[model samples]
Target chain A: MKAATTSETAEREARRNRIRLMQGNEACAEGALAAGCRFFAGYPITPSSEIGEYLALHLPRVGGNFIQMEDEIASMAAIIGASLAGVKSMTATSGPGFSLKQENLGFACIAEIPCVVVNVMRGGPSTGLPTGPSQGDFMQARWGTHGDHPIVVLAPYSVREVFTETIRAFNLSESFRTPVILLMDEVLAHMREKVILPEPAECPAVDRLRPTGPPEAYLPYASDRDVSPLAPFGSGYRFHVTGLYHDETGFPTGSPAKIRQQMERLMGKMERGAGQIQRFELTGAVSGGSDPVDTLVVAYGSTARAAKHAVGEARQSKRSVALFRPVTLWPFPEAAIRQVSGSVRRVVVPEMSLGQLAGEVQKCIPPKAELRRVNRVDGIPIAPEEILDAIVA
Target chain B: MANRIEVRFSGSGGQGIILSGVILAEAAAIYDNKNAVQSQSYGPEARGGASKAEVIISDGDIDYPKATNIDILLALTQVACDKYTPDLKEGGVLIVDSQEVLAIPEGNFRAYSIPIFRLAQEKVGKRIVANIIALGALVGLTGVVSRKALEEAVLSRVPRGTEDLNLTALRAGFEEAERLQRAEA
Candidate 1:
C-alpha cells in the first residue's frame, strides 16, 4: 500500500476527531474492523442483524470477508474455522439464535478457539419479543453451553462502550485463546448516541499467540504458560482440533488423568487470569470520605444506564448512593463488590431479567447487607424512577 | 433545571418517524456539539403499526437512553397521538397532523395541529417528505436544534438526488410553524 499524502493524512485526522452519532450495532461492527477482525460469518437476526449488515458492506472495503451463513449453527462453526486459518473472526446473534449457536459455542469453548460472539439479547426462551429489549440471556451467557468450560462475557451499556468493549472482547479472546461473548440488550443494540471513536492506532489490537518452536515439535493443546500459543492451519504446522478431551499432542485421550489435566488447564487459564479480564466502573460516593455511600446499586448492560441516572437522582436529594457497574459480566467482579458491600447498608441489583444478576450479587455481598432486586421481564428498559424507588425503599 | 430535553416522534411505521428522531439527534450531536441519544421501540411489523422514536439532547451526559419526561411530542396519526399523549410533560409542546389527529386529548401542554402530510404533498410535491417537514416544524417551534444544523443533518441523511425537495419541505414546515406562532400572537 502506498503511503498517504500529507493532505490526506490531515483530512483523515480531521475526520477521526469529529464526534459522530453511532448505533450500538454499528459500533460493534466498526470496533471489529478496527481490531483487525478480518472475517465475519453470521446469520441475520433481529437486534443483531445490523452488525452483520454493516460488516457485509464495509468488511470487503477493508480487505476483510463477511459471509452470510446458512444458520446460526453454521455461523458459529465458520467463525471457528476462519479463526483457525489465522483470521480474527466474529459472529453475532440474538436470543433464539443464541440458543441455536450454543452447541457449536460449546465446541468452540472446549476446542479453545479465539472468536468473538456478539449476542444482542432480546426477550427469550423462544423467539419472544424479537424487537424488545431484555437481558434474559445474562445467565445463559455464563452457562449456556453444557460444560464446566471457561468463558468471558462483556456487557456494554452505551454506543461508545459498545465500540470499546467489542475491541476488548477481541483482545481477551485472542490473549486467552477462548471465545468471548459481547452481550448487548436490544435497547443498547439499537440506540444511537454521540461517540468520538478512537483511531486504530490509539487502541492497539492483540493477535493470538503463535507457535514459535519448530512445527514438528508444536503441541496444539500443550503449554507451560497460562495460555498456549495456537498455530494457524496450513502454516506448515499440522495438529488436530477437537471438542473431545485430548492429550497435549491433540489426540483424543481416554485416561482419566489426562482428562482431568485438560479440564483443569482449560478452566485454570481463565481462573488465574480473571483479574486482567475484569473491567468495571464505580461512581458516586465511592470513597470512604465523610459522605460515604450507604446505598449501593449494582447493575450492568442497559439497566446500568438507569442505575447511573438513579444514583444521580438519589444524590440530589442528599441520599448516599453509588452505582457499581460490571462491564465484564462473567468472572463477576466479586472482590470489588465485596469491598463496596462492606461500606453500604443496602445493596440494590437491577436488571432486565428476574434476579439473574441479583442472584449473583447476593452471593458476593455480605449476608447483613440487605439486598434488594429491581427486575423486569416485560421487555421494557428499566426506568431510572424504578431504581430510585428501590433505592429509597 | 437539568440541561436536558426529551423529544418523541410517533407515527405509523414507514412514515419516517424513526428517521426524524435520528436526524434531530445527529444535528444536536454532530453540528451543535451537544450530547444526544436516540432510541426507538416498535413491534415486529415493519409498516402500519404504531412506532415511536425518542431523542434526548442534553448539554451534559445523557443517562437513561429512553425518554421519560417528554418535552416535545410529534404525532402524525391519531393512534400515535392517543397512545403517547399521556407521557408529555406538563407545559410541553405537542405537534400533530391537523387532518389525521382531529380529536386531541386534553393535557397541560401547548398543542399545534399542522397539516404536515398535506403540506408535504401539495407544497413540496412529494408526500414522503412529511417527516422532514415535521422535523423542520419541530425545530422551528422549539429550536431544539439550530436550523443550519438540521439542514445539514437532513442533507447528509437523505439520498443524493432529492436534497432540494427535502429542503423545500423543511422550509414549508418551518413556515407553517411560524404561521401558527403568528396566529397565536
Candidate 2:
C-alpha cells in the first residue's frame, strides 16, 4: 500500500510513522483515517469528544466528509448512509449517546451495513458519571440492541492498542459486513501516552465485498459466500434494505422459513470469523515456569492493566497467579478462558462494573474452581492494590 | 513500577496547570523516549474550579495509569496545596507558590516555597505562563526530563508569537529553583 501522494492525502501521509505522545481518542481517530475511513458523523460527549474534535479538524484535510448530526440517532443514521454509499464511516459517543444509537445500531446490523460505532464508556445506568470511567457497557454492547443478531466489540488496553484495534475494527466491520463497536472507557479515551504508530503501508485496510455482476444479478443480502457482497447503493444495485427480518435478496420477508435463514446468516458470518476475531494474552504464574498455577486472573480493557500489575505483584510475593486478558469482549473467548480454568484452583475476575464481566466469566469457570470477584462501582478504576489484595486474600 | 516517577500539577483551571502536565508527559514519552501517561480531572467549570493533572513516567509499561504514590506535587494555589498534600509519598517534593501560599504544612515530604507565579508575572511579563515556569523548575529539581526536551515540548504546545515570553518564563524558573537548591546545600 503506497501513500495517496495526491494533495488530498498528503496531509494524512505526513502524520504517519511519527512518535507522538497522544491521547487514546486522538490515536483512534488517526487509526480510523489510516484504515481508509473517509466519512464521520458524531455528537459531542465528554471524554469521547476529543475524537470528534480531532476528526472534524483533520477529516476535511484528507478529503473526508464529517457532519455533526442533531443527536446520536441521526449521527448513527448518517454513518450508515455514508457506508451504504460506498464510503467508510464511523461515529463516537459516550454511554448516553450510545443508548440513543441502539435502534439504528440494530438497523445497521440487520441491513448488513458496514460501519463502526465507537462508544467511549462512562459510569452509567443513566449519565452516571460523565467524566469518569466504567466498564458497565459490557453486556449492553452485546445485548442492548433489539435482536439476536451478532456483534463484534473490540476493546483496547493502551494508547497504541487503541490505534491498532481501531484499524482492526474497521477491517473486521467491512470484512464481515456488520457494525463493529469499538468499545473504550473514559480512562482509555482521556489518558494520554506515547505510541509508535505504524507506517501507512503497514496499517491494514479492508474493503467490503463488492458485486462483480450487473445490477440485475446482484443479491444484496445473499450469504451463500459467507459475508454477502454489498453493492454500493446508487451504483445501479437496486436492492431493498430494511430493519425487518429479510430474505436472501435484501427484501423484507415475514415468512418463517426465510426469516430463519436470514437470522442464521447474520449469526453465521461472525461464527465463521470467530478465530480471527478472538485474541487473548496468557502469561504463566511463576514467570519462567509452565507449572499449573493454582490461581488465575481474568480481565479486559483498563481493568486488565490493574489485573496485570497485580499478577506481577502477587508473583513477587511467591503467590502463584496467571493473567488472562481478552482483547475482544464479545464472542467472549470462552475456550481460552476455560482452558486455564480446570487446572487453577481459583479464578479472579475484577471489573469496574458491579459484576458484568464477572458474570460472563462464571459461565466458563471450571466447576472445581472457586470464582472470586474484585468488583468496584465507585466511578474510580480498580487499582493494582485492590486486585493484589484479592489475590492474596 | 519502582522505576516510574509520578508527578502532579494542581491549580485553578485558568492557570494552565493541566497543559503543563501534558507537556511534561510528552517530553518524557516522545523526546526522552520513555513511556508516560498523562491524565486530568475535569471540573464542571473551566476556570476557578479545582484543576488537577497527573503524569506517570516509566522506563517500562505503566499499568494503572493514575498516580498511586505521587513523587512530586506542584501546587499553584493554597486550595490545591492543602488538598493534594496527603497524597504525596513519604519524602516526596512539594513545590508551592510562595506569594500565594501563606503557610506550609509540616510533613515528611520536602517542601519548597517558590514564587513561581510572581516570577512569571514580574520576570516574564505574563502570569499566565506560570505553569511553564513551574514545569521548568520541576524538571530542574528532579532532573526527570532534559532541559532541551522540556523546552521543545513547551514551545511546540505554546501559541505562536508568545514563544519568547514563555521561554523566558521557563528559564527564569530554572534559575530560581537552582538558586534555592544552592542555598539549601
**Highest DockQ against the true fold, candidate:** 1
**Model 2, B1-185: lDDT tens per residue?**
86989999998888998899999998898778788999888666868888889999999888888887999999988888998899899989999999877787779998989988788878988888899889989998888899999999988888999899889989998998799899889
Give the chain B TM-score achieved by candidate 2. 0.97
DockQ of every candidate structure: 0.95, 0.79
Per-candidate TM-score against the hidden true structure:
0.97, 0.95
Please give the TM-score for the first chain of candidate 1.
Answer: 0.96
Model 2 regions more than 4 Å off: A1-17, A286-289
| Model 2 TM-score on a 0 to 1 scale | 0.95
Candidate 1: give the clashing pairs.
none
Model 2 per-residue lDDT at A358 = 87
